[model samples]
Target: MKILVCISKTPDTTAKIAFADNNTKFAADGVQWIINPYDEWYALVRAIELKEADPSTVIHLVTVGGADCDPIIRKALALGGDEAIRVNADSHDSFYIALQIADIAKKGSYDLVFTGKETIDYNGSSVGGMVAELLEMPYVSLATKFTLIGSEAEIVREIEGGEETDKVALPLVVSCQKGMAEQRIPNMKGIMGARSKPLNVVEPVAADTLTSIASFDLPPAKASVKLVSPDTPEELVRLLHEEAKVI
Candidate 1:
């Protein structure tokens, strides 16, 4: 089986987020970047597990970014990807990124494609679906469990108030979340081996960005807590009804 896993670089969770250009752009200076947790912990890890089960399975990692994303791709390779592909472009538009991935998937003729539910920075859960549409393949979102039998796949995905099971054929796409697989840390051997793995950079195909960020605004600061005496039940009720607006 040939599996293509889409990975993305995101700011570390602990990194302080700030905007630039009068709050119209992200300030990336001094921020440490890592593989988006959903991509690393769920999507990529699940692909690795499949490869482990069948040594003949080939796992390829692809990311849409510029040269700066090399380190993040190397880290993913260390986790067991056979090879890597980097799209030589950068865009915040989800469609543009998805187009690049779809192009690669087409050229590679992968049997299965995996992507995280969303990227941490943008939380735009649109790429996987768009890629599937572009490739004309079945798409399963929020997949928690995926099992393969011969050429068919049994998938369990999260849905409204419950989960749903799907049986799809090969050459489908899945957006993975928690319960897909546990996280794996790269060991010394894997890290050393990754240094020798091939990372191919390819120029993006013709694609137009459909959206642009107008600006960014931070959420309002938290309001100070107001205390109410236990004895004053009326005051508490009044506060809840009028101030906190819970009632």
Candidate 2:
């Protein structure tokens, strides 16, 4: 099976986020970049596990970004992806990224496409579904388990109360989350091998972006906690209603 894993470069969770251009652009001055956790731990790792099980399976990593994202893609390749594809484009919009991925998948004739449920930066879970719509293939979101049997696929997805399992045919897209597979660390040999692996660069097709960022703003500071006496219960209620707006 030929599987394409969509990877994203995101800032480390602990990085200090700031804005430039009068709050219109993210400041990348001292940020540390890493692979989005959901993509690395679940989606990409599951594909690598599938490859380990079946030697014929091939895994390729794809990312929509400029040359600065090459390091992130290389890390994914070291984890077990056979090769990498970097789409030369600005990934400011989710639809533009998905369109590029759909074009690559069509040209490569891949049977399966995998993506993380959401990126940590934006938390918008829209790319995989958009790619599926563009490719006209079956799509499963928030998949926690996946099994391939001949030409059919068995998938388990998280629902409201519990889990739901379904079976579908090939040429499928799935957005994965936790419970799919355990994360793997790249060893010395794998890291060395990744240096020589093929890294293909492709130009993005002409497509119009639907949205643009207006500005960036940080959340308001938290208020200090207040201490209330147990004897004045009515005062607490009044404070909740007027000050906290809880009632």
Candidate 3:
């Protein structure tokens, strides 16, 4: 089985986000970036579990970004990906990013592709579905469990008010989320091995940008909390009906 995992670079959760360049660009000055933690800890690691079960399985990681994303890609290589491919392009839009990833997956002849449910930064969970649509394959999203059964995948996921399972054929895309597997830390051996692994950088194919960010601004702050005396239940009810208006 050949598993292609899509990885993304994201700002560390603790980073203070801000915009510059007339509010049209992200301020990267003094900001720290990391592999999208959910992708690393859940999706990629779960795919590695499948690799461990089958020695012939080969896991490849791909990312859409510039040279600045290389170090983190190398770190993903250390985590377990046998090879890595970087689409040399600015991931300016979800559509374009999906196109780049889909093209690479097609060229690689990947049997299965995995990506985090969404990137922490953009929170756009569209890649897997887009790839599946482009490739004419099935896509299972928010997959919590994955097991191979004779060229088929037994996928389990949660649904509203209940859980559901599906058996999808091979050559499918899965957008993974939490509870898929335990996180795996990159050890010394894997780190050393990553240096020797193949890291391929390729120019993006001709693709049109379908969307662009106009500007970014912080969300409005929450309203100040108002305290109500607990001893006066009638007053609290009155407040809920009047000032709070939540009744």
Candidate 4:
């Protein structure tokens, strides 16, 4: 089986987000970048696990970014991706990004496409479904557990009120969140192997873009906390209703 795992570069969760140049761009100064947590922990790791269980299987990392993302892609490759394809493009909206990924998948014809439920930077859970739609394949979102039974895939997903499980055939897409697999760190051997492994970069195919970023801004800092006597339930309620309007 050939699994294509879509990895994204995300700002560290604790990085201070800010805008620059008249609110037209995200401030990168002093910010740290990391692999999107869900992508690393769930989608990518699970794909690695699948390959581990089946030596004949191959896991490939795919990213839609430029040279700036090469280091991160190399890190993912070191984490166990057999090879990688860097689709050279600046992704903005979900549709535009999905089109690029789908274009690559068309040529690769991967048995399975795995990606995180959402990118931590934008938190848009739209890419997987869009890619599936572009490829005319079945897609499962927020899958917590996955197992392959013969040629069929059994996926357990979390829904609003409960869990839903389903089975699907190959040539499918799955967007993973929590509970899929534990995160793995790349070892020195893997790192050395990654340097020798191929990191192919391909120009993006022409695709329609549905949207663009207008501006960037940060939410205001939270207000100071209010302290109330522990036993003063009535005062707390009154304060919440009158001052904070939290009730």
RMSD vs true structure, all candidates? 1.8, 2.4, 1.7, 1.4
Give me the displacement of residue 184 in model 1, in angstroms: 1.2
lDDT of predicted model 4: 0.92
lDDT string, candidate 2, 18-123, tens digits: 8999999989998999999989999999999889889999998999999999999889989989999999998678899999999999988899999999999988
Instruction: List model 4 lDDT by residue over 172-193, tens digit each.
Output: 9999989999988999999999
Q: All models: lDDT? A: 0.96, 0.93, 0.90, 0.92
lDDT of 1 by residue, 215-237 (tens): 99988988888888889879989
Q: Score candidate 2 by TM-score against the native.
A: 0.92
TM-score of each: 0.95, 0.92, 0.94, 0.95
Query: How many Å off is the CA of 201 in candidate 2?
Result: 1.0
Which of the predicted structures, 1 or 3, would earn the higher lDDT when compared with the native?
1
Ranking by TM-score: 4, 1, 3, 2
Best candidate, lDDT: 1
Candidate 1 segments exceeding 4 Å error: 227-238
- Give per-residue CA lDDT, model 3, range 44-124, as digits (tens): 898899888998999999999999999999999999999999999996688898899999999989999999999988888
CA deviation > 4 Å runs, candidate 3: 228-238
> In model 2, which regions exceed 4 Å deviation?
227-247
